[model samples]
Target chain A: MSVHLLYAFAGAGVFTIGLFGMVFMVHLLRKLLAFNLMGSGTFLVLVGLAQHRNGVDPVPQALVLTGIVVAIAATALALVLIRRYFHLTGQVTLEPGSRDDEGHS
Target chain B: MTSWLLDGLVVFMLLATAVSVLASRSLFRAVVMFIAFGMLMALAWVRLQAPDIALAEAAIGAGLTGVLLLDAVAHFRRGPDKERGGAS
Candidate 1:
């Protein structure tokens, strides 16, 4: 297989892993990390698949560049929100009355 | 031959770091692994022949994001005490 296709498959694998983490993990910060991983994996698949077919296309590359910027902005906003949530609630996980919240309250 | 080997290695490292970022018990260690994952992703971008992405991934993805998350981790660790003090 071509190198780009290989990368695309790898991206799929990464995306699956991220999805698993996002679903199973209870911590907000961990969820954010998983979200970022999902974004990165999607970017990889976009560029990899496009390049595999079109031979070094600039369109997908440009798109991925903008995507990376947006992803960081989203992550920053999420972190701020998480900090605010923790500041008020003193708990990291989203679940109300979770085991982690027992001692804090 | 060498190129394939290098690409495979980078891909492996990328997935490995991604897994570790989620699997690690310590939040700080997870964030650190995420930073390492970002670096490996930059290298993967280079391998995929996207130098622009490689540069941005290294700078923003690895550098800026890493610092942002590290700060968040620290805040989360120490947040409850400060909150208690403020609340009372």
Candidate 2:
């Protein structure tokens, strides 16, 4: 197979692995890392697909650029919320089982 | 010829990074592995001829996100150091 196609397959494999980790990991930080890994894999696949064109695919590249910025903004906001939850509950909180504490406070 | 070999090598590194980021026990180690994964991902982007993505992945994927994660960890450590549902 061609190098670009091989790279695309590789990206897909990594994307699957990252997806598995995201769902299975218990820690909030690990979940965040896995999510980012999946994101990187998606970006790799997009860039790999762009390689098929004779020239740059400005569309995918621009979309991925916008995605990177949005990912950071979301991560920052999530981290802030994670910190706030930890401070209030005295625990490293995850998504589930934390709602009751919020209602009490 | 050599580019193919380099491509395979990078793919291996990518897989390894994924495994390490998940398998690591220490929270700090996992975060470091995640950063390394981001860097290797940038390399893959470079190899794929997307310099803009390489740049963004390096900056946002690795640089900015790393700061945010490390800050989160530090904030957690400064507190009571308890697990989510344990001992509280």
Candidate 3:
């Protein structure tokens, strides 16, 4: 269906943009946010593609529900770790001094 | 009919907000916009006819995530060490 196709395209775009942010951003929290975007995009694609002639599929819906719960828990743990790291090193990024070292080569 | 138009608009808003979240200069602003983006995404789920996902997105994506992001922002603003001139 055209509606399905449109949503799929939008999902793809969201995924691509999230990947860009995850790869380029220095801030760990931004990377986490981008990761969430990527998760939403994936959920969109899953739900979008599961539609059939009769009606919507329930399988993907259940899976995505699980994914959402898992994602939130993972994000919470990551945030705690990041906060601890910040307290220890006062650096938000994982690889601070190594970035320039990698760029030169 | 009009439903198709709504879908188009929802998708448009999702893309727009997603881009803004990535592009915003201030990390705080980006986090705030990301919360907006998450809620808009819940709208997109509604348009997709997945009320369950819409609810989940609103709760987890927007609500919990927003709370966690705001907490992190507070840490970012309140420097760990004022003498070191924390800017990271």
Give the number of the best model, judged by DockQ. Answer: 1
Give lDDT tens digits, candidate 2, residues A61-102: 788889888878887887887677666766564655643112
Angstrom error at residue A65, model 2: 1.2
Which residue pairs of candidate 2 clash? none
Question: Which one wins by lDDT: 2 or 3?
Answer: 3
Global lDDT of each candidate: 0.88, 0.75, 0.81
TM-score of chain A of each: 0.93, 0.77, 0.85
Residue pairs in candidate 3 whose N, alpha carbon or C atoms collide under 3 angstroms: none
Which parts of model 2 have CA positions greater than 4 angstroms off? A53-55, A95-105, B80-88
Instruction: Provide TM-scores for the models.
Output: 0.93, 0.84, 0.88
DockQ score of each predicted structure, in the order shown: 0.63, 0.48, 0.50
Better DockQ candidate (2, 3): 3
Candidate 1 clashing pairs, residues 3+ apart or interchain: none
Q: Where does the lowest 10-residue lDDT sum fall in candidate 1 chain B? A: B79-88
Give one digit per residue, the lDDT tens place, for model 1 in B24-59.
Answer: 988889999999999999999998999999999999
Candidate with top lDDT is 1
- Give candidate 1 regions above 4 Å deviation: A99-105, B83-88
> Where does the lowest 10-residue lDDT sum fall in candidate 2 chain A?
A96-105
